[model samples]
Target: MTTTARRGRPRGEGTDARILEAAHELLLERGYDGYSIDEVAQRAGVAKTTLYRRWPTKDHLIVAVVAKIQDDVPVTDTGNIRHDLVTYLEAIVAGLDRMRRVGRGREPGDRSAGLVAEIVAAAARHPDVGQAVRAVFARRNALPLALLESARARGDLNPDARPDVIFDELAGAVYYRLLITGEPFGGDYASRLVDQVLAGARTPSPRAERS
Candidate 1:
């Protein structure tokens, strides 16, 4: 299907950008429950019918905003896997921190990070949302996965190392620390995370040392 057919806007047009920007700003200010789609349309200076024609629902708009946020982070192969991964993690952490400062309306302390936590819950509850979430991640994850694979091929990582597992570990650690443990990541967190993941598994096996 064509891009226009799917979303009612040509992929490069600025209407989508304006809508997302408005939605993101409002979300940070008022959180998930505080704003409505009509407010977003009004803020963007677009008609409500036009916005609905594209997003169809508020949840879809949320996904689009998140997608834009993820898409803004640049991914380049600088040949230094550690540096690249650290840069990416740092950006992700900074972005998430911005989103997490305000919780949902009722719970001031909600660790779910507002929009992200909402989408995660929505994805779990509704299969369609889950599909959309999967699509978003799949697009976002491709680059990092490729970076890991390149590092492995270049001998920067173990020959036996699985990029997917390592990717999960790195991302999982960050999310777990933020959402589950509520621990704050310091300025050096990205460097520390990269060093630990790379150094711990690049060569030695603890079992081998013991045996």
Candidate 2:
């Protein structure tokens, strides 16, 4: 069927898909701070009431857009703990690469950094925005959880250490470097981080001690 005909088919799967597509595009284009329900409705060619019926607030719409892009990071069983850790950190680096591209055309660190700052500011003002940000963080932590579990199973983690603690120790360092220090987070950084985490997590082998 023609695209116009399909969009005109009334309330169904296609309409919902179109609305979500519009929201996604707008979110990326304008960021959370500048997005508007009326613009989204116009872009989707749907009524403002329809958009409101689905998402009561901009926070809800932002969360829904994030949900659509959510993907599970694959946990690899590479036998070598260092390798698995590098792989996990590299996945995050890859995501940042895409975000960088999306934030292009603006001044240095203007697009992505500005958008993140705006989201944080919005969260401070709106409880619902804060909740949505928390939800996004929780959803994004799934992959890190898998990596931690795998390390624990392999006896690479200290017996007394909690998974959340380990995750914070590792992932939090990368985040601090990325968001705060604005350092280069390439493959070399990933390797170094893996080495650091492994040093802290792995028990020294008796053979290595003897050597």
Candidate 3:
């Protein structure tokens, strides 16, 4: 007689969404340290085991929330690198600004990184969390990277324009302001950033072109 292979029970529909929604709300209401997996389970109306089965650790769950935020932004290619880059960067700025407000009671124009700072610190403190955070960024950046590649191929960007370097310039400025200088990532900054980056990366006119 042959034994039948055992199969795990399927997850209940909407359980993950409920958990994520609860976690996101709690994260915004309370800072990262103030929230707990048990609180998430209680708010989500799901068992702690259910939450763990999906997210092995609290850091893992937090990374998942951050990933969701990243996934919500759209990256488009309209055959115009400047417009596309500006639009994409503006979306990223919006996400960062939103995350910056989470669990903070600062006045308007505050430049605090808030939960984003906690995320970075968590990643640094835990190797697995660092890998998870890096993976999230790597996956999220693929679209913008592809958009740059398309622009380069279409002659819209300079032949020497490196997408990774260009991305570093664009994203680094935002993070620098958020995490270091505490400068306001105000409106129009995205436009200015795109203009500067594209100006350096655009093909020069024949009159100004060097051999």
- Candidate closest to the true structure, highest TM-score: 3
* Two-way TM-score contest, 1 vs 2, winner: 1
Which runs of model 3 end up more than 4 angstroms from their true locations? 1-18, 21-35, 203-211
What is candidate 1's lDDT per residue for 1-211, written digit by digit as tens?
3334547445446778898878877776676567899999999987776788789877798788768778877788999999899999998888777677643353655565555665576678767767887899899999999999999898888887788988888888888877678787899998898898988658754566674
lDDT of each: 0.79, 0.67, 0.81
Indicate which candidate wins on lDDT. Answer: 3
CA error at residue 150 for candidate 2, angstroms: 3.9
Reference-based lDDT, residue 189, model 2: 84
- Each candidate structure's TM-score, on Cα atoms with residue i matched to residue i, is 0.79, 0.70, 0.81
**lDDT score, candidate 2, position 28:** 61
Model 2, residue 54: C-alpha shift (Å) = 3.6
Q: After superposition, how far is residue 92 of candidate 1 from its true place, in Å?
A: 0.7
C-alpha displacement of 16 in model 2, angstroms?
Answer: 6.5
Model 2 segments more than 4 A misplaced: 1-31, 44-50, 75-80, 107-114, 204-211
Report each candidate's C-alpha RMSD, comma-separated, in the order given: 4.8, 5.9, 5.3
**What is candidate 3's lDDT per residue for 8-28, written digit by digit as tens?**
656655777798778877766
